[model samples]
Target: MDLVITILVLLLVVALSGAVVRILPIRLPLPLLQIATGALLARPFGLHVEFDPGLFFLLFIPPLLFADGWRIPKRELFLLRGPILALAVGLVFFTIVGVGYFVHWLIPTVPLAVAFALAAVLSPTDAVAVTSITGHATIPPRLMHVLSGEALLNDASGLVALQFAVAAELTGHFSLTTAAGDFALTALGGVAAGVFVSAAFGVVRRRLVRWSSEVDPASQVSLLLLMPFAAYLLAEHFGVSGILAAVAAGMTVNFTDVSKGGYVATRVQSVAVWSMVEFTFNGLIFVLLGMQLPGIVGNAKLDLAQAGGGELWYLAAYVAAITLALIVLRFVWVWLSLRFVLMRALHRGEQRPKVGTRLMWTAALAGVRGAITLAGVLSIPLMKAEDVPFPTRDLMIFLATGVILATLLIGAIGLPLSAKKLKLPGEDPRVKEERMARALSAEAALRGIAEEQKRVEETRDEKAIALASRVAARVVGDYQQRLEAAGEEGDVPEKARAEAGTERIMRLAALRAERRELFDLRRSHRINDETLRALIRELDLAEASLTGLHAE
Candidate 1:
């Protein structure tokens, strides 16, 4: 009961924090604010929550990665492949090697393997942090794609490296060749598993859609939600990278309406359901992070003081040094790589443009770490072989926490300032592309209506045909207006758009009134719950369409 109550309270806090952040005059990053709120609620309030490392990985990561893969702009991802790979794979290994040595040299008490383990923990940037910061910001699509793609793939690489390092520590040995071979096999195997799982699920979903009369949207949504966990667990069971498996599963599922009759309700309901889950899960993770601070700090203090009174200062200095190194190294690598490696390849035939210094800085500042890093560090076993406490475990947690805070601070302050200073492209080309696509779709819809009108005319019943043609003409007129409004040429007038928006609101109010009447009827026993639900679903779909059309 206490545990359940604690979870409810934490969720309430998450909800309230989201509302509060939105109403603030100066918009702050949501994840950072949640972290601060969690920290505050931990002490004085005496809110204590324990999160198991294994459960944390299982419950939180798969869905987050899956959603990222599902939503990532595939076209942009392909175009930015070179830089994404350079950062995701190349920079990750570089950090593990470079920072691993740096940490080992700084703290002689910590083993080289443990140092590498810490590096691996910090290597992958957090996708949640990147999206939270850049979601509203006017950044280039290519840059956002690179950051997102890197976050998705690097989780697998970083975790694999961490596993090898831990294995080396336990055995008191290390092998470069074996580790490299295992890493390649794990990545490839994970991708294959994910593809297989996704394809299987895709067939099932399509079959269910074909049998729509026997299945409801709720059941379909429930099944869709299980996909990520299934892929992750299956890959893990096969001794492969679960993170990559989840990501690939998300990417492989065909969410678009390519089939003759796509599952509209399923798609719509699944998006809403997943979005809510993502919000709650992400919020809880950051809040849990704050709750862990008191214990982490206490452990670090005791461990460092036991080493020597002066060693506390050394620990602090190391944290600062590592945090600074992460920032500096990322900037240098991005700048140098883009100018030399990527540019040369692009000149040969790649479609990407040469990355400039401004974009490089943007990417560097965007390298913020969050929940994943904390989870990795905290997952370090408390005891290793012979029941001895894991070497530097406390210190590693402390350092990881410090790095997370440092990067968040840097990102929150630097991202906006750099974006402003650089005058990075504020306009998203995708917005224009979406508008054009909608216009084309509306034109096609009009043509379909015209064909229906022609068919009705062939019935040759004057009265019935006249009524049908009038309705068709009205629908065609609406589509024609929408098609003209979303013209491909020049910008629409702000006043006209605002008026159209106002008109939409008026129409929505009328729909809502109708919905209220239907609910009232159900409450009064004039209609059954089943019928009410069916009618409500229609209203929900209408509202969803209106909301989507207006979303920019």
Candidate 2:
């Protein structure tokens, strides 16, 4: 009962946080608001929540990472692959070495391997937290894509590095050659596992759907929801990177052409369900972080006192120093990368894109550490051996959590200031491409409609011919207008576009009226529940057609 209550309460808080965000005068990101709310629950109200670290990681990280992989623009990821790889792989190693040395020097009590472990957890930026902090439109689209791509790949690398670091700490041994082989095996195996599982599932699901006359949207959605977990567990079972597996599964799903026909409800339900899942999981993680904050600090103080060494104030300075070090390191790396690009551009005799100070700072500040950091830090074992607590476990947790909070705050403050009013140079060709696609599709639709009309004429019944002609004219008028509007010729007048807008407005108004009338009928007991649902669905489909038609 207590466990159930805890879950319900957490969910309630998550839901309420959205409302509170609107009501608050000062703008705070929802993640920050959720965390503050959790802290409130923990500090004054004595709310306590705990779980096995392995289970916590298993529950929240895979689905969130999978969602990121699914939704991030694959084109941008591929185009920016060079820079993204630099940040994701190269910068992770850079931070691991630099921050590892800094932490060890600052606090000699922390072993070198343990310092590297701390740095490893901190290196992976939380692009989700950044997105929440700054809306996508606020950041330059290309830079946002790079940040997202980096976040997607680095989580796996950071966590894998942490595992090796932790092993070294335990056994007092380290080997670059063995680690390199293990890393390759782990990453490659994870990708292979994810591709295989997702591909196999896609094949089986496609066959089953084809064999059956009917499809169950609920079952299909359930299977989709299980996909990330399946990939994660399979890779973990094989002693590989579960994080990469989950990511690979999501990216594979995006590439797979499983939504070709007659699966509209399945796709719709999948979108709605996955949206809810992402929000709930993300909210719960931050809220849990908030709840744990008070305990983490108190325990760290005790650990320090018991160790008979460090002062209480040293903790704050440590967090501040680490956070600053990370920011400086990131800034320097980004600056260096830009310079390297400038040199290459000059060498190739190409126009050098103007490098702005604000852009580099925005890129640096956007590196907000989030849930993955929290989970990895928390998962550090409590005991090194029987009757021996892991050295400075609480202290490390305190430091990592503190750094997460610090980075979030810095990003919240700096990103907007740095990124404001900046324009990226390259034009997105998607607009032109979409217009062309619409024109082509409209032409093809016109041909199909004309062919069907001709078939109707062949029926050779006068009344049928008359009805077919009227219907074809009505449908063909819309497509003809659509083709003109979308065509490259650009000869269509502004008035024609304005009229099309008016028609859409009228159609949307009629859809809303139908919805209201159907609901009124239901309320007056004139329509059965089943009939009401059918009517409402029809209205919803019509409304959907009007809205988000051009959305990417």
Candidate 3:
């Protein structure tokens, strides 16, 4: 009961923080606000929230990664694969080497292996942080794609590095050749596992759909929600990288096709379900991050005191130095890579897009660390041997938390200002492509109507011929209107766009009225529930199409 109450209270805080962020004039990011709220609750109010690393990983990480993989633009990810690999794998290893040595030099008490462990903890950028910062900004799509892809893949690499570091520390030995082999095996195995699992699930789902009279959308969505967890657990059971498995599973299962078929309810319900899950899970993670501060700080202080130096300021300075190093290193690496590597690669092709200085800075600043870092740090065991605490565990957590906070602060402040300063264009080519696709679809529908009208005319049924003609006329009119709206004119007058918007609003109002009337008819037994549902589904689809058509 207490646990239940605590959960309810945390959810309430998440909801309230979401509302506050939107309502406030300052336009603070939601993660920053939620973390502050957690800190406040923990400090003055003595609100204690225990950290369970296992449970956290099980509940939050899989779904988050799955959703990212599902929604990521696959084409852009492939196009920017070079940079994504550079950042995700190359930069992560670079940070581990650079920060590992830096930490060892700063704190002689910390061993090199343990230093690498700390570096590994701080290496992977959080997807939540990246998405939240980029979602509202007008950054280029390719940049966003690279960032998203890097975040998704680097989690697995960093965690795998951490696993090796931890094992070396425990065994009092390290082997480079063995580590390399293990990394390859785990990473490759993870990918294979993900592909196998996703394919099996897809086959099963299709079979179920084929055999069943009607598969409930809610049940199908429930199965989908389980997929990430299943993939993760299966890969883990085989001693592979579970994080990568979850990501691969998500990318493998193409929900877009499923959503386009007769599974309208599944599409609609799944969107709402996943959206709610992301909101609640991400909110609680950040808030709980803040709540962990008191315990982390106190532990670090106690450990330092035992080591004969209890200067909290010293630890703060150390965290600050490492945080600064992360930012500076990332900036330099990205700039050099763009200047030397990416430019040369692009020179091979005509009409290649060039990366500018501003874009490099944006990418560098966007490396905000969040939940995954904390999870990695906390998962570090408390002791190495009987009655002996893990070396520098407390300090590592303290520094990891500091890095998370520092990066978030830098990203939240820097991203938008840089975007505005760069005068980045907001136009998306995909929007134009979508409009063209809709116009073509409308044209196809018109052609189908015309063909049907010709067939009806040959039948010599007067009523049917008249109905066919009327439908064909309506289809032609709709097609023309859509094609005109999608035209590449010199400019569309603002007044015309306004009128089109107003017309859409009026059409939506009429659709809603028709739905309400159908509901009333069903209630009055003038129509059966099945008839009402079928009509409502049509209305819902119509409204969705109209809403999507005009949405910016």
Candidate 4:
């Protein structure tokens, strides 16, 4: 417990290190370095960080997965559904079976069940690690969408697969038809649990918001944060997929009526809180990977007598094989699946962008291993129920960790550079033009109001107009500064400022007032629930108008 606290403190420090590293011009693969630092600390000085396996699962995976699923742009995900499904579901099965066969052939001493266990452990792609790379890469939005979407959905599917594989291994009963049935049932359970639980909570929250005007912000935030965990726990307790349940719940709230008027505050708070959780959890997992090493080495009877040359050689070879297979398998799956989907879309006269071979290659290279692999590897049963050894657990953890390191380092360096080389074009100019027009128009309105304020002087009748004018100037000035920054960076053309009009600012101001009221209602418990909810809906539309007005 003491060590755990120490490691957590260290993780916080290292997470800060990661953030600092990001601001540097030099390109360093952050996860690779973090993990390497972990490995070195473990292997040499014996700084170990161990976490409760069940607690680790409960603490980290759900929220991370939920965030990814909820934030994925719905339209893009739906459009690329075919290819994404093929890569996520189809290729996960392929990787598991293909790697299972390869492992069995390479290590004949390992049981077929153990080989399958290894395969399941290796199946899921790490969305967060991939995002961390692509997040910095400035890749084409479409490609990022596809990669992120695939990674997110595939994780849920892969975890379900892992559970089934583990159950099969434990029971010594592996049946294909049963596996398929279980998969369907598990997925349905997750969706059902998420919908039922979140809807109930949403209803409760709505009622509470109506009556609890003085509820502490902390308590409100806590309730929202706990929603995912409660859903996950209940789902898992019922033998469903907890991760999927959390993802579903997050998607439901974020996509549906979760926001009252305090969405901006909610969003701001969520990001700040989740960002910290993500960093600490991620840092600790990687560090724990290192901490677990000594125990793994002790159990494996691995020797550093030859400067660990032989063990390193074997581990590297295995990691290389798995890494190569994951990359190649994705390409094969995506290219074939996309060919079919694109042909279908073309036949239907859908305006689909051409997915060239190059983009497929980029996606293939972007599948870096991270938290999912770590979680699965760490969760491996070291001993069967009979107190007999669960075969190959140590070797498997080492191999999984090796793959994580190799792919993360290589992928981080390569994917971003590869994405840049793809030279995907920028956003459509007409959209940019419309945005600039709105921005300039809003600016002109502010100028007009400022002029009116100066003309009105201190007359009693003009006081409200003068106040209104001042607010307009502040809001428009804020937006104009943003536009000018964009223009300075060559994101928007300088000529866009000249083409806009000024008639929309008063409407925007009116909308802002309503939005402010809605936010207040959201924070207030004494408000009439029905009235607040209805007002929030109107505020959302008004906010959209304000966004357009500023962009002009």
Q: Give each model a TM-score.
A: 0.89, 0.93, 0.89, 0.77
TM-score of 4: 0.77
By lDDT: ranked, best first: 2, 3, 1, 4
* Best model per lDDT: 2
Task: Give the lDDT of residue 424 in candidate 3.
Answer: 51
lDDT of 2 by residue, 1-552 (tens): 988998999999998897888888876777778878899989999899978777887898789878888888888899999999999999999999999999989888788998999999999998878987875447766787899999998988898899899888888899999999989999999999888878977887877777885778898889888989999999999999888999999888865645557688888888889999988887898899899888888888987776566788989999999999999999999999999999999999999989788888888898899888887888787777889777887888889988988988888778877776577545455656777898899899999998998898898989999998999899999988877767554447345566678888899999999889998999999999999999889888788878966632
Off by over 4 Å in 1: 24-26, 134-136, 207-212, 255-262, 306-315, 341-355, 424-427, 490-499, 512-540, 550-552
Model 2 lDDT, residue 202, Cα? 86
User: What are the lDDT scores of the predictions, listed in order?
Assistant: 0.80, 0.86, 0.81, 0.72
Please count the clashing residue pairs in each candidate, in the order shown.
Answer: 0, 0, 0, 12
lDDT per residue for candidate 3 within 1-552, as digits (tens), equals 877887888899999998898788876778779888888888998888775556677778888878877777777788889889999899999999999999888887788999999999788997567667655667666677788888877877887799789888988999899899988998898887877778887778788888997778888899889988999999999999888888888888884345557887798888889888878888888788778777878988886776668577988898889999998889988987777675676687645556677877888898889777777777887778999878878888888988888888778888877765665555676676777787688678777777888889999999988887887787776566665666554355344445567879999999999999999999899999899989998998899878877463
Superior by TM-score: candidate 2 or candidate 4: 2
Q: Flag regions of model 3 displaced more than 4 Å.
A: 134-137, 255-257, 307-310, 342-354, 423-426, 451-460, 490-499, 509-545, 549-552
Residue 59 accuracy (lDDT) in model 4? 78
**Which tens-of-lDDT digit does each residue in 59-147 have in candidate 4?**
77887776666677777788988667877888888888888888778666666777777777777777667767766466666667677
Cα error of candidate 1 at position 302, Å: 2.6
Cα lDDT over the full model 4 = 0.72
